[model samples]
Target: MTFFTFVTRGLTRRPVRTGLTIVGIAIGIAAVVGLVGISRGFETSWQTGMKSRGTDIVVSNMGRGLTPKPFSATVVERITPLPHVAETCALLVDLISVEKADMMIVSARQWGGFSWKNLKIVSGRLPNDAAERAVVLGKTAAEVLGKKVGDTLQLETEELAVVGIVDGGAVVEDGSVILSLPLLQEITGNQGKINIVDLRVTPRTTKEELTRLCAQITGLVPEARAVIAGDHIRDSQAYRMISAMSWGTSLLAVLVGVLGVMNTMLMTVFERTQEICVLLAIGWKRSRIVRMVLWESALLGFLGGVGGVLIGVVGVQLLVTTPAIRGLLEPELNPQFLVMAVAIAVVVGVVSGVYPAWRSSRLTPSHALHG
Candidate 1:
């Protein structure tokens, strides 16, 4: 019989136990796929949105690396006259945690400006009254909050009316509420203060010119730093933390899978002690026995990898389609990441088999057969 057939026969001896071991490995891989996939999707979506918007540069207070200090909205006046600056808009951003629900970071944006043009309203209209407490929801924010046009949400002490829903396609905006800059300023008690200043530059502005302008903008306000829109994501500590957590959590799941495989292979070695001894007595080399045990473990891991991929796909689909997480999370199934999951499983299998395989190979035929 072929080597693979031999390994297959051994695995089939206890089909139920083998199946359970495969499932144990599968669960770990699925966790890695889902968590890491979602985080990567979030990063890609945010970066794409940042670049797609015609806005060329972003200006924000360069305070603590993660926490940007708010600057006076009047800084827009200083930035507008800078060379290559076509338009400027001030933004106020903050996180509002709904009682018993996920926290949403909402943006208070300048209405009737070039920066606002990118937002396409799906249903309803932009807020007409900047003075009134009016808010617009991104497709995801609406679903998460379960609010629609004309519905009122009590934000802090004030009740704000939802005037519109937008499809911005950016995860950050899609999962957020938007309000008129003035209203947000009033609500946050930081009137005439802002968090970000986005700038659009004239067409044909060279990269060198853009760099010079960024330096000039920084000089204009010693507290503020200007950077390319895409680079802003790199500067964000929260984004880095999320990325770290995704892989970090995945590592734990992989470790659990390793342990499961190790336990299962060890048990298999003990149960097959007599069979292994007979093979040894018949002149099967110790190295050959080691290879057989490893091959069996590898097969189990491969099967588990396939099952894990399926589970991850189905689970992510269900999550993204559900109203609560739909707009907020767009799970990405990157081919490389899926491949890595399978590779991890194979490695875990091989590593887990080593000790058990070695112990079985060392058992003398006399002792193994008599025991």
Candidate 2:
């Protein structure tokens, strides 16, 4: 029989054990891919959303750590007149429970600004009074909540009227509840508190001008920081931390799979002791025996890798389709990610088989035959 055929036969000798080992490896790969995929999807969605709205920069309070701090509304006025700045708006962001759903709702407001023009109201109308208890629902939020124009929704202890429904096409806005600044302040009980400020620069603004403007804005409010929204979202410490946590968990899962592979390989070595001895006595070199064992382990890993990719893809799909996660993320299967997963599996297989293969090769013909 050919070398490959021999390895295949060996694996088939215990079909149940082989299948379980492949499954163990697959679960590890799936966990890594699914978790990291969700984080990446959130990042991509946020970046694209801000870019689509022509938002040039964002200003916010520099919190103690990676979390964003809420600052006073006066910060917006301080930034409005900066050089190269054409317009500015502030937002109050909060997470509130909705009575109609089991998930937390992202509630936001445009604090003190000219009529915000980026979003289009497809039905109903925006709040006429800043302090009025009215809500403008994003398209997705309206659909998910099953609320329509003039419908009353309970938030906190207050009954608010849904004044409008809007479509921004950006997942962040489309999935959020928006209200006027004053109304949001009343509900959140943080009067004059705002979390973010969006800035739009003049068309002819140069890079130097933008930098100078940011510096001036920072000078105006030393507690706040000015950042290009795109760069900040992509390279922020918070983003890195989340990605690291995902991979950290993935590493643990990978180790578990590696152990499973090693145990399986060791078992294989024990089961084939007499066969190895026969081969050695018949003049098959020690290196050939090692190669045979390594090939078998690699073949198992290859099958495991294939199974892992399939499971990972399905897991990502389920996460993206779930109502709570669907609004904020759009999980995509990256070709590069798949290739990396497969490569990891192959490496795991090779590494796991190394000690077993060495031990198998070192066994004397007499000892292996007696065993």
For residues 162-215, could you state the per-residue lDDT of candidate 2 as single tens digits? 999998768777777778877777776878888778788999988888877877
Clashing pairs in 1: none
Q: What does candidate 1 score on TM?
A: 0.84
Model 2: residues with Cα > 4 Å off, grouped in runs: 62-67, 102-107, 111-116, 204-220, 234-241, 283-285, 365-371
Q: Point to the candidate with the largest lDDT.
A: 1
TM-score of 2: 0.86
Which residue pairs collide in model 2, if any? Answer: none
lDDT of 2 at 302: 79
Q: In terms of TM-score, which candidate is strongest?
A: 2
